[model samples]
Target chain A: MSELTPLNAIGEFALINRLQAGLTLRQPGSVLGIGDDAAIIRPTAGTELVMTTDLLVEGIHFDLSFCPLRHLGYKAVAVNVSDVAAMNALPTQLVVALSVGPRFTVEAVEELYAGLRLACEAYNVDLVGGDTTASRGGLTLAITVLGEAPTGKAVRRSGGKPTDLLCVSGDLGGAFLGLQVLEREKQAFMADPETQPELANYEYVVQRQLRPEARLDIVHELRELGVHPTSMIDVSDGLASEVLHLCAASGTGARVFSEFLPLANPTLEAAAEFNLDPITCALNGGEDYELLFTVPVTDHEKIKNHPDITILGHLTGKEEGTNLITKAGQPVPLKAQGWTSF
Target chain B: MSELTPLNAIGEFALINRLQAGLTLRQPGSVLGIGDDAAIIRPTAGTELVMTTDLLVEGIHFDLSFCPLRHLGYKAVAVNVSDVAAMNALPTQLVVALSVGPRFTVEAVEELYAGLRLACEAYNVDLVGGDTTASRGGLTLAITVLGEAPTGKAVRRSGGKPTDLLCVSGDLGGAFLGLQVLEREKQAFMADPETQPELANYEYVVQRQLRPEARLDIVHELRELGVHPTSMIDVSDGLASEVLHLCAASGTGARVFSEFLPLANPTLEAAAEFNLDPITCALNGGEDYELLFTVPVTDHEKIKNHPDITILGHLTGKEEGTNLITKAGQPVPLKAQGWTSF
Candidate 1:
């Protein structure tokens, strides 16, 4: 019970003013940031601009009952930045449009913005402009991130060649497993209000679910190691789905080695506890925010020793079809059981 | 009733495929469009990139009962484009993110996208990227527009000076009056379903409300006339509000002559029919999507004879305060009763 000001009391202008007061423009290209009809930025010459947008609807993409507003805000920006990284680009700026419900107080909005600002700082991106309005149903966040890559340097999903080594950054299945843990806790709490849910044991997995970071570090490291991914896409829709996307875009097929699929220890332990297959989770669990990419076979040696990079498989001709080779030496057609909002 | 396919029937990816099938990328700088994690574009050298985003929530921004889905889609793009035009920039691309509800069908989404494509063609801005997801409540659209202006050529609201002649493109009060008429008709229809709405006489105003176009033509005309506006803003939230915005941004005051305010005859007639003051409607009516700007006194002759342009008044020192010179020879302080979503 603390005194809190409702958003309606101060009006839209004052709310905007409060939200923008702490923003500091640090991007060199940002000529004008906020406080205008539009934001102005000067994109550097000889660089291609990479842009992506993502929309997260309440009750569809997240459940506020268990999800913190700050984490929601962070995830929104991180997901967009992940898209930027998928293009082999460095995110420079972002514009967020939010539709907040009447139930949200000024303090709640401030908390959300604080997370957004923190993500901006972490990603080295500036908050350029956005629009905020009232929502009749639930809160919605739509974020558009602007990034830059040197001319002819952007790695597209269509660039993978046959026999290219497919690689993935960091471990997978943790986020999806983390979500399961959170949902279970939520259900348990609902059944008995006095019961305190135990989440400390699932800290690593839960954090992965709540505050997944974009794999910008992998993008930077690849560049530093003199390696450019032949094809790239962020793993937002599970490894199996993303592998298929890269293959389809490149007019090829892929053979993913089940043994090589990276799964965190916590993810495996949680999968066993839940009576789920860790390998299945690794293949089809989404929201890892990791980079799934392909590199020419000749450059594989340069990336093989990298602790964060895992070589998962190789591309094949179209006739070969997309398949996941089991540890038992059987080939099964890869199925894309990615999340469907519908 | 005709058979229709629900959105969930085809799922998110297939629906996206259907919607993007007809999109043709016409921008030279567009290196990538859709189907990837992010879109890529090569911004022209030495030009500032102008970015803006707007969120339109159903029930909050529009009434689905009367507002056609097609017009909602069109207005979403046009309003974002209007912001780019206000910055004195040419809109080059847009990314639209939409959250639809379960009630939407594949055909309904197609209709919405058809309208979006039509607006993209009309505005000559490429549809580069977007996100599509499901919502639990009403449909929501968040659009981000990217435009470009030559270095140091983008106009800002803070550049106005004292004695600058304020001008507006097209007539005002029509859109607001149109909303009023639509609401009245809706009430009447609710009262008696058998009675049809008598909207033939209010067609012009109704169209203004339903499909208001952004004044990009005025931006081009001013450029062609060799007149760079000292300050400019789109009249999205009424004349009084926008006038006050320019004043506050520029640290100056403004005098808007009530007699010189642009009002369509149809709007005036509608106001009389509703027993409302025409002048008040002209001053407080929002969503005209027209351009309100100021030009140096020396360039007045170049724009005075333009058929769509109307010179209202002039800016004054901050101490003079923003006011409207009444037809009765008395000046009244301008009030910003702008639309508040809160």
Candidate 2:
């Protein structure tokens, strides 16, 4: 193990805060989120309920050598929230079950809760009941989030149409670029104990890696724009992976020109610093937590000039194929490596 | 590490099945309790919801050197359900998260889930959704459960009155004694690997430890009889500890005659064989999963003849103090050593 990547490292709570920061909550139904005994949700009569849960373990979903505990805590909730958001439902309550090794303490727990609370507040969620126990090894966080949509509006990954225009919100590849910077800094810090990490200049890239926000804003914006996605998913396992997911579920294919890919300024700067192509980072980077969906072409003119939203591509025949066009005009196939936790 | 205890050991799914084979589901709302993507639940409207969670980690909560995973899994959910039952509520849903090390296989996860699912079915709860992740070390199981009661009928720990008749459901000390049998068997097996774990003779005691059930039946009976508990709690952290919780929360003290302590016939047999006192086991051993509570004096007639219910004590003014009566007619102070996980 690298000296900088200390083994059996990380107190439980510190890892939590690294994952929760700078998010927004725009739902009125979210009465509570992230830090409490149990979340209390108030759903109108005739409304149904949906709940989902997920768990993340160190040495599995992340390497503390590169991942921070605060970010871990934030990601724990974010991933579950993403699942709820994928259902196209508004989230209201979350319960966390955390198991920490002796490597944790009161301070560490507070840090984790701080990040959890931040995420809950951003998503207009309430942190309800949870479990806390001591683990014999690396940190493990299990979160169950509760969501409520109107009586019959809970969207599934299986809901899409043949002519839906595949749309994506915000930019991708920024988080992947951010990870590159962190990994390099970690390597430099490991090479010499006295070396100071020069991360000040890569603020945006670092934020992408350390604190990726959930795309609830798009969920809300679409509702207000009166444009509902035929189907949707958040990019956690990578963009290509998510695209295939929408296609496979909707039984359709899609085509996108690489020139239209969204790239944050920081992404280009960071990729340049590392002497790497920015498009690759944008295409395959995971943890962006951005929304990927399909809307009818009629909705295209409705959001064509929108600043953050992008018309990445459009759905097609199942046999037509899912491919990305290069700016150099070469066609490239899209494949999802899928996140390997094993 | 006891040879029989299976130190750092996780059972394959088959063994887990064998372990859960002994318990039977006893509730009607237990739909799709254990083996599915997520447990499904159905609760009638106008019911108040009560939820609680508990997490158990190896080394911290149990020493596999002595504790078994099958038992641990069952205990984890049973204890939390007991909390809901203590409030005179019916458990409805459960979500389980487990983190495993590389030494385990899919079979092990299945076994753990089997135990968890068994408890859910036994208590009429749906499995709902949960997370499964990899752990860097020993087994970690975290479970959160949801329960329900009539909007205004859910009993709380703070409802006892000065003259309430304190009661306990079922015999105590068997589960505690069962734990002792397991510990002793572990020691004996460590001395001789060929031992078949002579627990057949101590079936009652061992079952209490390995497959304890929540007293949900008592809660239902009370409702049917039109009797409501003034205050309640499960006998999880020892009877003494639970009595104190009731007293402190109800703003009163308890006075009980030692002769009124209830112990199973099997518990007495095992106590004699182990050279132990059954009353001590009843008083201090945790994990009984039985309800310890108080009812208004006028309602005593409602449950007095109830087969499974036992009258153990009564509530009094703070000036009376919390006391335990000895078989010898002497008052004794109560001591609680809650399942020490620290």
Candidate 3:
């Protein structure tokens, strides 16, 4: 945000020291934080550790044209936090490995770390340790999040059973529409450098794409309500792909009701503007980062009235196969057409 | 090594499935390994967790011209493990995040995983979870390693006392010399496509460069010998840099005896061939992944006879400052000059 300083000017250790200077450990489990060969954490006596990693490469994962460095940094940590939430665990510590090309300035890196620090505080997770290195290509970030859940209480995608209610947290398809809006704006900007693309109407979708939050709240609320999910996963790859994942992992089939799929007003508006069906977008539009979990049918009433949750379907016998029940009573096979990395 | 198959042909999920199929959890702490949103681990009672991360960028940290994918994979994991060893911990689990460019094939990815698996077995650590994505440039790897040590037993870089004896594990400078040999061979190969590497005489150095091992054995031996290091760090950067880190962190100074620095015969030969000083290679030729530590002077006799360790020097009061006692008995201030990332 200020004067640009080449990374080479300060050197690696100096950069690390500068970035690590203001970090404070807030987690009780954090025995040591940063500045050592490794950070140390003392896990709670009866808790198990849930570890997940995500690698986000520039161009492939985000474009610098519309995606600010700060937002990219926040999203990187949030995505991994979402995975931890999917496990029904509370994130405790995180380590980041950042690789930056020469084009990046010290101030740019600080802004990215500022976003990371914000996420760390939001999640109440400690920034324990990390590696910072130079890259020959664009910026890349790899984050590994460590979380904890009561021993044997962490949910897995393979724990669902027949007759389990499939529930999803929050509305979907916003992130996908958000991407479409950004892409359109990017195209306009590219066509004319002086063009001031209008984006006021797309604020919600844009935020969904640029700064998606992890559904840790859903994990917390479920615990508070005395409801234990039979199986859980995050809607990172869309509702359809995640439901399929649950079914395959748990050896059960699911019937998702198309009409019951939650749609936010902004998402519907964006879908209409883009000439797309809101239901299809909700089903296959990925990067929502919402929690999708299955609870025993008996616990349905406990969470049914939750403001942010929607009961989308129920698990059935594996022989039934996974499908989406249309509003007209037709059964359509579900397919996983989520985002592909390669 | 087999018929090459493009990565996109099989898709991401299929690729993950293929890579994850044969993974078996060996660590008793591993409650779950792979396939879930996150891997789960149960730390042993009364032990603290040590975590560290490392990012390896293509072209910057390594050149694929002479570096095999498998060795690259192994080195990535080993380097993180080395950091764990630096904290006096036993590595238990690892997570990898890989970004590969379009030029890479699925089979090539398999080769990389094969190397990862080999390292996992060698280190007695479990390959628990990872993220794999396509890169827009050359391959990049980020690894996070988790290890455990008895409560309050894990060493830190800030624990050295003024009178502590500084020691190092194994011979140094070999890996640096190895890189030199490989780079020379790469140049020759590039100059004439028909050129053979003629690497018979430089096997040891070449291996050191391509596949450096972590010094976990030193950690175990120190434990068994009833000798605890006052301070410890991995010599990822050269000895000079690492010694300075110890001094700065411990609020003390150190005197490194150049004559006492251990250099293997092969390393010496390579240094001679390159017309470089063996001492300089040992001091500033990094990538050795050896352990640099300081132990209480009283415990020196216990480790002095150990085959792999060399007592390099002793810690000094802060006023003395860090310096290297040359072979000719002149004291010179030690400068890092280790490999710079930026």
Candidate 4:
């Protein structure tokens, strides 16, 4: 790293000028981007826009001790993009408002923005505009993402029907297990300054925690497969929680089978190492950033052999209630024990 | 306030449910609103959308000792709406992200949302979606406003040409003056706990600081009068700073007359009380949220007699430089002494 430039030395306007250097609007609808009072976007003639916002506050959402600024920045963008994917929309533009404490330097802020830029490129979204201000506490990021979907094509959380197959992309529980590993390492370091983290065996789980990617690929693939989800939501608050959300919004019930949960080898091993039940971890752990949706029973054939997706359950009549069927054939009510900032 | 219920007691989801109560989508284009992964908006035909974001951090952009949460919320929306108005658009929707410390009660958060809802109703904008989370510091607000404008009617900051008349809506400097009064009262109260603030005589200026409205009405009036501004910007960072921005963006220069600045009676009186030059305050004090623009000389006849509009000066060649012409006929180079969070 070069010598750090104090944020105040260059002032807000100069820092903004430096941050915006070499930036280009890649989205065709982005008529005007940064350096204006507001960004202008020419909406596609037959498209509806989806908007979402997420806030990440230091000491609440992430710890500076282990969470690198760059990865945090990427996660901030990916989370909002995940919401857009849940709506079956393709992200187009984003505006980030960042508040940094006095301890931050201009170079440090640049590194954060660099990660944001990388995610924007990966998601094919344009960095339209943003606000930068000073915070009395630690770093805070508020990101708002705008995505576009063809007229009447965006999915909603309230459109599910009885017997619809509830499916989820990728595996779950890895991110939460990964956080456990990181927490253990941090504790070891605090107990002895010379302690080093042994993460070689937990690489996959660690990556899931530190740099989760939005499951936008599934959205595109589903479109190509001609399988429109009846109801959809991102797995931001664990599978059990999101399943409940889908059921509540759709005014239906669900039956999730413990034996059918898609669990990665890494996540299973980490859960065993932590002496935690793999099924419980899969059901209640959060932050996987995977897409969860329900499709008509007839559409299941198209996605049955899809390697990255899993059929976890099916929607049922509202009177049936939401439950998880165990291997022993016992039905236990599902609960949402997802992460809560409060 | 009712019995102070702690934020954690209700949990994040319940808190969200409480906050979103009775929030109806008034905009015809708002297809979906809160309680979903993302909000959906169907853009009006042949219109472009404008977007902007602003962040307000406690102890940096505001002092809660003299600022109410409701007023702070209103100001946050107004500031972002001001940016949209600068683009000559009508605001359509808004998304707010709030982070509150443990000290904030559920009732307090409700108060803040009340103000936000009031602003949404006032602007005829929909409260689409938002994220609420815990903060380690005081309250922080990040607001993003979305507005709509006709296909090619949205104004930009780079259209000013030499000799275009510089125009501004309403008076300036009252917000800054109001802040000074508040700070003074806070100090006196700190020295003597029972000392009451002497704000009766400074009600107008005090209100300016506490709750400044965005000049969207002027944008509508300009359109109705058929006077299209060649270039426009909101007077957020004072008249001089915005003039410099217009000049820099348009590759022109400007000459502002000291005597032509519109000053409200309360602002003038407050300036005298603080022993600050009225011209200096109007040229440098920020947060007025008024519109600053330039129009072709031919359109001057349309707005010349408008009660709220004032013609300050005119654009000049780049070589002439941006200057404030004093009543004594001396040209003093303009400088941007706007607020800097750093």
RMSD, each candidate, Å?
0.9, 6.5, 1.0, 0.9
Off by over 4 Å in 3: none
lDDT tens readout by residue for model 1, B134-167? 9998899999999988888999999999999999
| Candidate 1 structure quality by residue, lDDT tens digits, A86-120 | 99999999999999998999999888999899999
Cα lDDT tens digits, model 3, B162-193, are 98999999999999999999989889999999
Using lDDT as the yardstick, the better of models 2 and 4 is: 4
Q: What TM-score does the A-chain of candidate 3 achieve?
A: 0.99
Question: Cα deviation in Å at residue B160, candidate 4?
Answer: 0.7
Candidate 3 lDDT at A95 equals 98
lDDT by residue (B1-342, candidate 2, tens digit) is: 422322134332233334335434343443323322223233456765566667777777666665556666777788778777876777877777777676666555555667776677677666655655556687777777767677667776778998899999888889878878888888899999998677888889787876778888888888889888888888876788788878877889888777888888999999898888888888888778788888889987888899888888799897788889777777776666455443
Q: What is candidate 2's CAPRI-style docking category based on DockQ? A: acceptable
* Candidates' chain B TM-scores in the order shown: 0.98, 0.85, 0.99, 0.99
CA shift of A132, model 4, Å: 0.3
What lDDT would candidate 2 get against the real structure? 0.71
Per-residue C-alpha lDDT of model 4 across residues B90-144, encoded as one tens digit per residue: 9999999999999999999999998899888888889999999999889999999
